[model samples]
Each structure stands twice: as C-alpha cells, then as structure tokens.
Target: MAIVDEELPTTIFDFLPCFFQVIGIMVLVSWLNPWAFIPSGIATMCMLYIRYRFAHCSRDLKRLEGITRSPFYSYLTSTIHGLKVIRSCHAENICASEFFSHVDTNTRVEYLFLTTTRWAVIRFDWVTVFFVAIVTLLSIGLRVFGRQFSSADIALTLSYSLSLMGLLQWTIRQSVEIETKMTSVERILEYCSLGQETSVQRLPKYEPSINWPSHGRIVFDNVSISYFQDSPLVLRGISLNIEPG
Candidate 1:
C-alpha cells in the first residue's frame, strides 16, 4: 500500500482510473435499463465527492504527522539557538507564547480536519442509504403496477446496484487512504537514506580462562594526537609504558 502511494502519481492520478471505471459501469448499467441506475448514480456521485474530500483531508493529515515528528525537533533546536537573544531581551515569555501559539494552531487544524471528514462521511453514507430505500420502493411499485418487470428482475437490479455502489465506495476510500499515506512513504524513504551505522563483521569467538587478568598493560613507543581537522598535531611523539596494578 505504502509503495503504491509512493510510486503512484498524486491523489488525482491515483483516482483517475477508478473514476473512469465507475463511470463506465454507471453508463453500462444505465444502458441496461436497470431499476437501480438512478439510485446507484446518485450514490456513486456522493461517494466520489466524499472520496475527493477524503483525499485532501488525508494529505493534510500526512503533513500534520510530518510536522509533529521531525518538525518538532527543528522547532526546538531553533528555539534553543535563539535563547541568548530571548534571555538578553527578557522576551522569554514572548518566545514561550509564540511556541505555544504554533502548537495550538497545529492541534486545531488536525482535530478540525479529521472531525469534519468523519462527519461528512457519516452524513453521506446515511444519504446513500436513504436513496437505496427509495430505489427499492420504486422497484417494488413498478413490478406491481406495470407487471412488465419480473420480481427476479427487480431484485437483481437492486442487488446489483447496491453491490456496485458498495464496491465503488470501498475502492475510492481505499485509494484516498493510500494517497494520504504516501507522505509517510516519502518520509520513510528519506529516513532510510540517512547514514547507517557500520556493522561489525562476525568472527569466531575465542574462549579464555575464567582467571584472566582484570586489566591489561599498555605500551606505546610513540603516540601523537591532534585536535582540529586542519590544525597541526597537538601532542608530539612520546613513549609511554604502564603496567596494570
């Protein structure tokens, strides 16, 4: 899933193929003169709108997550770097207030975006259910009044419509989630690219006596040390010997 988001084009691109497929299905169902076409189209449109909103919401969430993770460290480091000016100017409270304000903004944005998306999804789902009920009633009435459509035909149409609606909704929802998580994929890739610690090569172990010396002697014929990368050596050559006591 993560790889799909990372490798797949943006949310718009990711949704295009599915969107086209659903449109094709809707057209086919309409041509078939199914009793469920009207309700199914309505449901499909609602689901698509919800899906678009969800994609945007997901993007926001990914950004929020990124900010909350590494961005926090950057913020803190910057704040610390400016501590001297803040202290000197007696603006510690100002700095604190600014930091808190940014944090509050992030919190509000995240909470509101998630809440709105959830509520919208629930509302649209209810609307779809209502449409489904209406379609079922209409199918029943047509079957009774006209006697042109069979009970089985009506049932099949309704079932097919409902199933198509469900499939499209699920597909769009899954795609939105994947698009949103794409940001995390990018982050993970970036993290992986960071330098990794060199691993020690495995070697055969050598067993030693339990009564081995606790300390070892050091003998150096000459040693030198340097402090700076571009500077001359600090310590000159010297000989030293020391025995562990």
Candidate 2:
C-alpha cells in the first residue's frame, strides 16, 4: 500500500518539467507584452485539473485496496470450495471466464484512468508549445516596434520562468499526491495498531499446572475472570472435587 501511494507522487514528479516549461514560455510572452499569459494561465488551470483528477485516482486506488481484496478473497474461498464440482463437471472454461471477467473489470477501470491522465498531460504539452510560439512571435514584434529588448534578457527570462514554473507545478502535484498517500498511510497505521488476539493454549507462568494428588481433588478458592474493569465477573469461584475410578 505504501508502495502504491508513493508511486503517484513519483509519477507526478517525473512529468513535472513539461508543465513548468509551458508556464515559462507563457511568462516570456507576457514579458514581450503579448497575451501569452492567457493561454499559460489556462494551461495552469488544466494542470490543476489534472492534479485533481490524479488525486481522485489515488483515493480511488486506496479504496480499491479494500473493496477488491474482499471480493478477491471471497472468490478464492468460493473457488476452493467448488473445486471438486468444477473438476467433476470439467468446468475449466467456466471458471476461466469468471476469473477473467473480474480481472477485465479491474483492468478496464485502470486503463480508463490512465487514458484520461495521458490526455491531460498531452494537452498541457501542446499548450506549452503554443505559448512558446506566441512568445517568440511577440518578441520579434517587440524588436520591430523598437522596444530594444536584448536577446540575452529574453533567453534568461525564458529559462528562469520555465524553471520556476516547473518547480511550482511539481510542488503542487507532489502536495496533492502526498495528501492522497496520507489516507492510505493512516489506514495502514490503524490496521497495524490493532491488538492481537490472545492464544488460548498459552498461560501465565504464575498459573498453576494441572496436577492431581492420589486422592484426586480440585480446588478454586477464589477464581474470577472479568473482560473489563467496570464489568462484573463472567465466571466466579464455586469449588468442586472429583475422584478417579
């Protein structure tokens, strides 16, 4: 579960640079007094949307951990129980169909999620390219208009803007991913903190061993067992003895 949670952030981090580059190009266009900021801002919103979608996916994935596990375990137990009937009836094909159906449902859901995410990333990339072209054209126009901006200044702005955009985009993506992952982490911690069941066969060292004298007698002078501090005793002493034949 931790591994699954970690993967989302890692994936987002890996693709963050492209998003930043797009924003940087927009900033450059803005510097040249062009409307490049418009598309860039739109692209930023798109990126935010993508992050929201992924955050939702991460949460769904975590939820699936429980939902799928339950059905899968149920299927396993049912399969095992019906194995004899399956073999006797030669129902291999039927079993295979059932198994694959479950697998296909899971696969379809995952594929849909991936496809949507991929489309968002690709769209952002295109937006970035569009903004870069706008900035370039605007820069040329500014030169023609006698604004006299240096090539080095343009280059530096583009570089720094791209870097900053990229860093910020990645930071936002990572934050969403972390928030999603924390849900899974909390569940895991809750599970881990649960108290273990006591073993029936184990007894404390101070407990008396089962031994008998020649007369075969037993005693319970003051025995009691209580489940909670405030609860009445479930069992109480009523001494008895028995003799061997």
Candidate 3:
C-alpha cells in the first residue's frame, strides 16, 4: 500500500503541475476580460460540486479495491509455494477454481473503480464545455460592443478558451485521482494504529522453572489460537495432553 501510494505516478507530485496549469489558465482568462470571472466562477462551483460528489465514492472504491486485491495476491503466493503438495494431492482443479474466483472478485472491484472514474471525467468534461461556451460568447460580446481589442487578442483568448476544456478536466481528474490513491496510505496507517496484543499473565504457581520437567509431557487447556489478533481462531477451546514415548 505504501509503495502504491508514494512511488506510483498517481501521487500528488504528478498532480500538482496540472493543478497549477488550471490556475494559470483561469487567471489568463480573467485577464483577457474581467467579466470572464462570472463564467469562470460559476464553472469553478460546478467543478467543486463534481469533485465533492466523486471524492467519497472514489475513496471508498479505492479502499475496497485495495482490500479485494490482497486475497488474490495471498492466494496466488500460497498456491505457488504449495504447488508440489497440491499436485501430489491431485487438487489442481480445486485450487485453480479458487484462484479464478479470487481473480474474478478483484477484477470486478477494479472495473467498478474504473467505471466511476470515467463517470467523473465525463461530467467534468461537460462542465468544461459549459465554461468554454460561456467564455466564447462573452468574448464575442466584448469584441462586438465594448472593446477596440485586436483580432489577435480575441483569437488568443478563444484559443485559450478551447484548450481550457482539457486543462480543466485533467486538473480535476488528477486532483481526485491523487486523493483517492491516498487511501492506500490511509489503509497502511489503519493497520499501524491497530490495538497491540494483550500481555499474558502467568501465575507463579503454574509457571514452570527452567529445566523443571523431568518427564516429556505437554498440556493445553481450553487453548484458542489464531494467526492474528483480528483473524478467526483456527483452534478453538482445544484441550490436549501428550506424553512422550
């Protein structure tokens, strides 16, 4: 999770440049005509709304994807390690079916994440189109009634207006992508913040001295065991007494 969050191309370091470019373009548009702020401001609000709606959904999906991915990797690794035993036991079909099930589950989650992403991009593009249309119309009005601005100035503004669509979409996409990707870091931190294991309290009477056992014997009383604190117990209430041969 840490590797995917920090070392991946989707990190904030890669998103910052696009964010700055969006700001630069907005500034340039407003400089072209102060009235452009009316449309730009409206577009900004719409973009913010879109970002707000998508962020929650995207973050959840990303976290789910991260979780669903783990079992697949774990199963794959274990299967590879146990290939010899599995083959000798003639359990290849069962193992193969289980592997595919994990793959299918992981793939379904990934597809949903990608689909939600596309949905956000499409909405963002629509917002950008609206902004560009407003800018173009405002530019035409300024040229027709208010300004003695050069043809070149109008052309440049229109050109920037057209390019703004891509910049705006890219900026929003990166902003949300980076935010969603940070869920990986959040998951890692979650594991870090888990409660520590409780210390065992051994009674002095029951505690054995060093080299105390003369007979080779072992006893377990209502012993429950699990691989991890949160995992289900593999051995529950096991009582066993063994004597050496």
Q: Pick the candidate with the highest TM-score.
A: 3
> What local lDDT does model 2 show for residue 77?
80
Arranged by lDDT with the best first, the candidates are 3, 1, 2
- Candidate 1 on 1-245: residue-level lDDT in tens? 44454545555565677667767766766655465677776776777777777678678776675666455557678989988888999998887887777777677767876776686668666766876787788788887897767777676667656766655765676576667667777777778899986764435463545876556977777887676547899888978999886
lDDT values, one for every candidate: 0.69, 0.63, 0.83
TM-scores for all candidates: the values are 0.50, 0.52, 0.81
> Per-residue error at 138 for model 3, in Å?
2.6
Give the candidate number with the greatest lDDT.
Answer: 3
The residue-by-residue lDDT of candidate 3 on 1-245, one tens digit each, is 55564555645676788778878987997787677778878888898898899989988988888899999999999999999999999999999999999999989989998999888888988888888888778888888898756678778877877776677777777778878777777887899999998887768897988988878888899999987769999999999999788
lDDT-wise, the better of 1 and 2 is 1
Candidate 1: stretches off by over 4 Å: 1-35, 71-113, 185-245
* Clash count list over all predictions: 0, 1, 0
TM-score of 2: 0.52
Q: Which clashing pairs does model 2 show? A: 20-166
